[model samples]
Target: MTFYFHFLSRMTLALISVGLLEACNPKSDTPQQPSGKEKTTKTEMLESGAAILQSDSPLQPMNIYLDGFHAAKDNPAHQMEAHHFCRQVNEDFAQCVLFDGNTRQANLIGIEYIISETLFETLPEEEKQYWHPHNYEILSGQLIAPGIPGIAEKELMKDKMNSYGKTWHVWNSAPFGKTGDKIPLGEAVLEWSFNQDGEALPGLVEKRDQRLGVSTNEKRNDRAELKDLAKPQSGVDALKGKFSMPAHPLPGVVDKKAAGPK
Candidate 1:
């Protein structure tokens, strides 16, 4: 009987110790979902890069959205917003981390690497399939930095106009209507750009403008003179443009005015 009582007391002591541990650590019992006000683990991981960024850091992170359809034939246009922290990895090459749209708590969704046209032209035809021109993105105002002045934006685009971008999106959030994504789940997709009006959703751009407090239409109008700028490799297909892309689900494609990718 005495031994039984001792075992019961030890079990009670163990339970009490666990309770004390719980008391010491409020989050020990429950997992934490990142709140809007807090920087998520993913955001921290991505932003931690800023610490290592060169003091001259060619480009600070700029928030922008790209409107396009997924690689699937039936997929409709979705506005893909990303915060690009562009840093020069070398003299003529730069790399960027594409984080989710959330300014406060973003997750790393993809990556973009930019190279000068001089360097791009050196790439063999087959090798070019992985890259896309930035002119279409720049002139159309689809690639925008919100709240910046007109001249500042123009200069920014001008610098990027001839560069080439290679992007791969790992987080597929279009099914959620571009709302939210917690984890980087599912297959990685080769992302494309909306080269023109017919290919993009009208409302998505407006929603992005309102949410971001910038005007895509105004930016588009300001860039009218830039429309004639020659983007030679802005081809109809990713291969023609020399954009390297994955085989499955087609490639990061541009649509011809004819039937639309359906």
Candidate 2:
């Protein structure tokens, strides 16, 4: 009977030991499954990527170009003019225009130059481009609205190959291999002639002339008249012209007069 009791005691001890081992290594402890909360957080991040791309951060590669004329691009005004020309094409076609120039947004006037791939690569890895790689560099500056200030202004339109929400007015043919080996002088003139026909050339010249306060056409007489009326003169005349006048003068005219006399 004592031997039977001893055997039963040993069996009971063995059973307890097995139960302790099982408790230490729980059956449900197969590597923990991801929590529902964690999965939801990841999903939210994916959905927000698009909005992040369009944000004002310089890193985002929106089509907006700033005035780079203050930087390293050899000629500033000519560069701006080229951008302006493309703007005309973009506007006339009601299509996106690819262009490049002195973009004010960059903060560095003459030192910074923006390129297509450079801008696109600036975007974080998640967002997709509106154009193919080849299509992006070559036709990117093809204006959606002629001379629309890309980064300078915000508006929605199909630009070049991309139906983008906003873009800057500037372009580059060299980086895309459109300009060939020759960094052509007076390329702006050639480009103007190459792309524009009929009255387009005259219109561009007229626009430039107006920008400089030099008239290229007699039709500018109307603009000239408007310019004369917008000037602020002594006391009462200055107040009436500046504040109460119905028709605002063309932009540069007021400044031009202000420089000359009282």
Candidate 3:
């Protein structure tokens, strides 16, 4: 009887101790939440980048209904309801080259999308079979992340200062050994540059930049005419001046293009 009483007392004390401990430090089964300071810090970091990405007119104007520029306009009401939604999302899609200017672990926020079909028709069989848009992978800074001066990774070093510049990082989408067989939705590579007025540098980003496959030797569809001019007149004389170039899908790529408001 004494042993049983002693054991019961000990168990009661243990329970009481546990209750005190829980009272002192409440246990939460839920995931740990960021403190106010931590959340603010994160929000600031994300906002800083999103602001840069949404700083002004996008470097490349989207042809779609809700390209980067039109994001705000598309859902003003929703944006008002959600202060950081569009901004954060836009920045997220744009990709971050470096965290706080660090070059390591480039965070992917956006991509240079091109469909595989376009490349299929444009690229030769050898280049075509291997480079599928879906298989094309992109590095964070290659497209939207700011560019670095002096060191050109994929293409020309024209504005090559070693400072941050923006260019789309183009890649062969093919996974390690597998080649893609379908027409990829995001296929094209683009170079993004901003003008002094904060407008997208159309000539630079769309036509001149090499990262988007625009070089002196390589020209986009519109400039294909210029390519003809560069070629010797022998081929020119045999060919009509007309040349058909691939059309870039407008920027807003959400399905049901006609479904939304105009």
Candidate 4:
């Protein structure tokens, strides 16, 4: 009888302990489904072990995160959101790996290398065609650093003014009106910035804003004081007259050469 009572008490204690543990560490109501393939128990074990054992020194410095939109240079309407995991190489240079989304399941779609105007000027005139200016992206507030304070974001934008980015999209991972390919396909294409209003597909920015809980127009207004820091940038007119709708001018974003002698 005493043995039975002890067993029952132990079982009750175990059940209560499990209930307390579950309450402390609740599972997500909507668990994340990363990638199409489900992770098997073996794969999950291997991944967890590798994470504990592996050294990720190279990836450690990719701390800066920025989200922006991109359009194909050859086809302006082929636009998509780019999440940048960047490493600042120096005062005048930075490099980024572009992803389709901010989540871990996001597809690695492209790369972009940014340089200061001084570095950009040193490039051969022909080489300049591949790079797109950033002033419009900054001033229009389409580019943002999620989770950062507004003041810090604005300061980051100020530093990026007059810079230029050379980008290439290697994967058509997330195309509009179609399911994204499971693997990368097609030739890699040059991507450019939205230099003018109405260039991005309708609802592209809106959908992104809704998902991220941000307002592009609000950021644009907040950065109005930083307008004075913007200098005319190269490639601002690269997509001139490309969109179906008329271009609406954004103040403080200008093409360097266009702003110069006629």
Taken over the whole model, the C-alpha lDDT of each candidate is 0.52, 0.26, 0.23, 0.78
Residue 158 lDDT in candidate 4? 81
Tens-place lDDT per residue, model 1, 11-51, is 43554566752332112111113334666898888778766
User: Order of candidates by lDDT, top first?
Assistant: 4, 1, 2, 3
Per-residue lDDT tens digits for candidate 2, residues 219-248, read 233223232223321111122222211433
* Candidate 4 Cα misplacement greater than 4 A, ranges: 1-37
Give the per-residue lDDT digits (tens) of candidate 4, residues 13-122. 55456675233221211112234667799999998898888866676556566889888999987877888878777778888998877655666788999999999999
* Separate clash counts for every candidate: 9, 49, 30, 0
- Would you give me the overall lDDT of model 2? 0.26
Instruction: Tell me each candidate's TM-score.
Output: 0.60, 0.19, 0.17, 0.83
* RMSD per model, one decimal: 19.1, 30.0, 25.2, 13.3
Tell me how far the alpha carbon of residue 31 in candidate 2 is from the true structure, in angstroms, after superposition: 63
* lDDT (10s digit) by residue, model 3, range 98-134: 1111112212222323222322345454542222121
Off by over 4 Å in 3: 1-54, 57-106, 109-112, 116-119, 133-262
Q: What is the lDDT of residue 39 in candidate 4?
A: 75
Candidate 3 is scored at a TM of 0.17
Give the best candidate by TM-score: 4
Q: Which pairs, if any, clash in model 4?
A: none
Task: Compute the lDDT for candidate 1.
Answer: 0.52
